[model samples]
Target: MRVPVELDPDVDDEAPTGDTITVYDKRHYVTYLRLLDAKAEGADWKEVAQTVLHRDPVADEFRTRRCWQSHLQRAQWLSREGYRKILEQAVANKL
Candidate 1:
C-alpha cells in the first residue's frame, strides 16, 4: 500500500477520467479512500463534498455535486481496477 500523503482539502471541479491512473490519483489517494468509506457508511454526497472535498454544497451546489460524483466514481474505479496497478507496482519494487 502507498504511504498516506498530506491531505489536500482542495479538490477540482471534476476528477481525472480514464482507465489508467494519473498523477491526480496519486495525489488524491486519501481523498478516494475517504470517499469510499463515506459511501460505505451511507453518507450523503453533500456531506461528503463538504467534509471530504471541502466544498460548500449550498454555496455552489452544481460544482460541488459534480466534484463529489466524479471523485466517488474514481474512488470506485480505484477499489476495483486501479488497486491492481498499485499492487503490481509494489511487487515490482520488491523485485
Candidate 2:
C-alpha cells in the first residue's frame, strides 16, 4: 500500500535516500533540526511519521515506518556532515 502523505507547505519533503547527501538536506535545514530534536527526546517513529512527514501511519504502516526511519537517519547525518558545510557557506557568502 502506498502511503499518502500531505507534505507541510513550509517543509521541503523530498524522498529520503541511502545516498550520503541530498539537495533537500540543505534546503530543509530547519526540518532536519526538528527531526534531530525529536530523536533526542526519544520520540516514536509513528509520531514523527505522522507529525513531521505528514504520513498516514495507519494507511500504510511499512512505508510510513520506513519513511520516518530513513529521514531521521538522514537528519542525523545532516547534523554531523552537511550542516557544518551549510554554516560555513553561509558565513562565506556573507564575507
Candidate 3:
C-alpha cells in the first residue's frame, strides 16, 4: 500500500517521455523514498504536493533553494512502520 502523496501542479503532469528520467514531486519521489526507507536510507516528503513542485521560474528557483532540503528532512523520521505508514497513505492517495 503506497501512500498517495499529492504531486505539485506546477511540476507538470505531462509525464516525461525520454531516456532522461526527471522525476517531479510525488511521482517517483515517493516510491524511491519508500525504497530507500526500506533499506534504511532516506527520502523527501514535503514537496510532494503539486503546489510545491511548481515549475514556475521564480517559484521553482525559490523551492530549489529553500524547500528542497527541509522536505528531505522528513526521511530522518524513518522507523519500522514509518515507511509502511507513508506507503499506506500514498497508495490511498495515488499520484
Clashing pairs in 2: none
Ranked by TM-score, the better of candidates 1 and 2 is 1
Better of 2 and 3 by TM-score: 2
Between prediction 1 and prediction 2, the one with superior lDDT is 1
Q: Model 1 Cα RMSD, Å? A: 2.4
Q: What is the C-alpha lDDT of each candidate?
A: 0.88, 0.67, 0.40
Ranking by lDDT: 1, 2, 3
Tens digit of per-residue lDDT, candidate 2, span 64-93 = 787777777778876677667667666877
Best-matching candidate per TM-score: 1
Cα lDDT for residue 5, candidate 3: 57
The residue ranges of model 2 lying beyond 4 angstroms of the native Cα positions read 1-23
- Residue 38's lDDT within candidate 2 is 87
Which candidate ranks first by lDDT, i.e. highest?
Answer: 1
Q: Which residue segments of model 3 deviate by more than 4 Å? A: 1-60, 79-95
Q: Is candidate 1 or candidate 3 better by TM-score?
A: 1
lDDT score, candidate 1:
0.88
Candidate 1 lands at a TM-score of 0.86
**Worst 10-residue stretch by lDDT in candidate 3?**
12-21
Q: How many backbone clashes does candidate 1 have?
A: 0
Question: What's the lDDT of the predicted structure labeled candidate 3?
Answer: 0.40
